[model samples]
Target: MLSDTGYPGAVGSDTYDLIDRQLVHALQLAPRAAFSRLAAVLGVSDQTVARRYGRLRGAGAVRVLGLTDPERLGEARWQLRVRCAPDSAGAVAAALARREDTVWVSLNSGGTEISCTTRTPPERADHSLLLQHLPRTPSVLSVAAHCVLHTFFGGAQSLVAKSGALSAEQVAALAPDGPETAGSDSPVPELDATDRRLLGVLAVDGRAPLAELAAACGKSESTVRRRLEELTSSGALYFDLDVDWRIFGLRSHTCLWLNVVPSELAAAGEALAAHPEVAYACATTGPSNLHAVVITRGARELYTYLTTRVAALSGVQHVETAPTIRTVKGPGPLPLPSPRDI
Candidate 1:
């Protein structure tokens, strides 16, 4: 049965039950697992698992999506901070949310700044959003682009995995076969037209049925399944969940910019990645060499985290916190605007 709690906006008052959390964690381990398989691991009826997921998805509490890894494709990933006029931040964020390349579009710094991540292919470097579009926008006051150097966590790694709702045995049982990436010496795999079509379908729904994927990709079920495995094993594709953290009693979301000693940069990033509060952490080229997105229960928890956990780290000189005012986009693609809206 569904909970009696209301579907709160981004930060809500109600929390999901243990079963719900366990189910989410299970999915994080095996996103494309069959309903029967998930039920077996979760010790719940298949119908119950499906119903709970449906309810959560209907309430906009969770979403499952398939995403490409920019590194595997030899593309450039950027973290952008766009400072806009006070009155223009909302419009600027909405415009950015409409972009296919932009993800995690957020209004931060009291809604006067927009933070987002964008992926650029090699061919589009000359005409990318950072180099061309944002600079020409009249309402944009300034733009800071940080080239992502290395990700310590948060591509296929999900916070739910750290929730401890699932047992170690269950996690091992659901772990997918094959490594996520090839060695550096291995040649990068290219995505053909068929692979692109398959990925397009999965970008919307990672758990789409085999028959549905086969039809959409104009291939047989066997072929589609094989290709899916190939992409995942090659580290060219991954499944991610966009979950409303409020459902877990986490109400505060903030981005942290930190400058660490060059010698300890890698250690600092790895340490941040292990923190359950950190949703994403990476090393980037900028004045602030380390970047992380953290979520906490509320203002008090965020303060405590900064004072204790973050302050305890070594070689950390400074920290800048940009509280997210609103999030307009997540991990998935958004519907493109029509000519009239544009």
Candidate 2:
């Protein structure tokens, strides 16, 4: 079992040092890699790698889980901002987190703002979690939903890219071959029963053992391996690393909603993607055509980023910032149930 030295607490930079950061980057490459393999790749002992990962996991600083492509599952991903009365924001956010469909539930802007990402199925569109529930609650002041159109960059790969710990060669070695085709606009073939069962286990742990996964799906090891590869290549599934940035010296996370001229939306997104501090930036379908998540050491740093960095961008007319008070659900998708269960 892993030691609980940093468990159930926020680990500062002193507790999770530079070596821990490298290990995190390694996990970004192979989320479920064996300690021996990670040790060899990272030039550390197997025990060291294992211990580090244990402490990080125990501290709630990092998590590795399998995630399904929403589009492949024919689900819509929505970015939502909810405003509630000061006394009831926590209750509302907690309520949202309890629902199976919600992810990344966060309290922001003191205690009155809640931001979250929700995956809604087509059948539940009219009766969505927030839509169906929030309106009935008197505490909820207003809610706005933005559809996630195109993801230029986010998730595990983007996290590692911002780390700058690995050299180009190391990155190349860690990168999976072929492009990310998940959530493609082109038609995706329907997933079969076996495919759904296989995805169920993977959603819990992306790097689950071949034999274990084969048993779960009632298939031979070789068959399961082939199917896993096929699913990845075909864009049916993908993996992401989930971790808190505070362990890496980034003590604050803030989301920036920007109103950029329509013509410059793409340009602004591309520019935000290049910044190391910008973890996620994409175009959405609201007045704030561009949405960005940024990490910094403190309020002062965040202020500088807003004034000097973000303001420098052309065509940016308005900017709204909300600092994350707490994260209730995930930095990545929660484990999805099997299709039948859904």
Candidate 3:
């Protein structure tokens, strides 16, 4: 266990249990909802909810982050699978994670493979800087880049929400009001400098207060609110709930590459997305068109899921599994320097 003065440890003993799982689901439903409101929804006292939230946050088990929609910004998102020498895999993966361009990074294939996602502006999508650097590194054995074509489910959704703790009605009640239709008519709306600044702050902490956002963006509270609403309406910005999977006894983290019949691709992707173990699923352009991430309690649970849930899907021709040994970087905002530093 980490001392109180130090950073939260990976998994505190017994910090996660049935009630903790329920609370995580509640937060997943409403990432920035008020404690009292969440308390009412979960049928617990406000203090209980607050205390649990504090514990989870202090343990570094859960985090709420705001992310910009790359598609909305006309940026191309790429998934890179890189194989490296066993001894140098950690160095390679860490190097990729340290770049501001990469967001999600995982070390898989018994620590010999690294997988990550990065975005490139429209004009430079063909030649991302990270892509250029990897090939020149002697440690990298091979690399395959897949352009994400479509997401059946998973940017804003959380794996914790799939635990079935809350009913549909409860989730609907807790969900924040979505933006009204306004700027979505255009497929791509350009973001100005102030919009970028606003997004930079939001990315770090989605629940930042209006006053702080106003001060950072040099705008009035009302203006900041209106801009935020407009950004959401246009699909330019959204929030994601992230968690340390270890806390939930889900130690097995694996990525699946699936080749499904063309006609049944959508059906297959949707079915996988609905599984409680799945955290991410998307269609991409590569040898395997569909990619998914699953976390489970252990190898046995993973086997059950693959044999029963996954194998049951029709039209799945082949599946490849790469179990992640360590997470170089999990999902969230890019590791950019803080706004103050900038």
Which segments of model 2 are wrong by more than 4 Å?
1-10, 72-74, 122-124, 177-189, 332-342
Q: In candidate 2, where is summed lDDT lowest over 10 consecutive residues?
A: 1-10
Tens digits of lDDT, candidate 2, 211-316: 9899888999999888777776666666776677766677787889999999888888888888878988878888888898888888999988888879888899
- Candidate 1, residues 204-295, lDDT tens digits: the string is 78888999999988999999988887787778898998787655677788999999999999999999999989999999999999999998
Q: Against the true structure, candidate 2 has what lDDT?
A: 0.75
Q: In candidate 3, what are the lDDT values of residues 64-92, reduced to their tens digit?
A: 67778776677788888999999999888
What lDDT score is found at residue 234 in candidate 2? 63
All candidates: CA RMSD in angstroms? Answer: 4.0, 4.9, 4.0
Q: What lDDT score is found at residue 290 in candidate 3? A: 92
**Colliding pairs, model 3:** none
Query: For model 3, what is the error of residue 240's alpha carbon versus the real structure, in angstroms, after optimal superposition?
Result: 0.7
Better of 1 and 3 by TM-score: 1
Ranking by TM-score: 1, 3, 2
Ranking by lDDT: 1, 3, 2
Model 1 worst lDDT run, 10 consecutive residues: 1-10
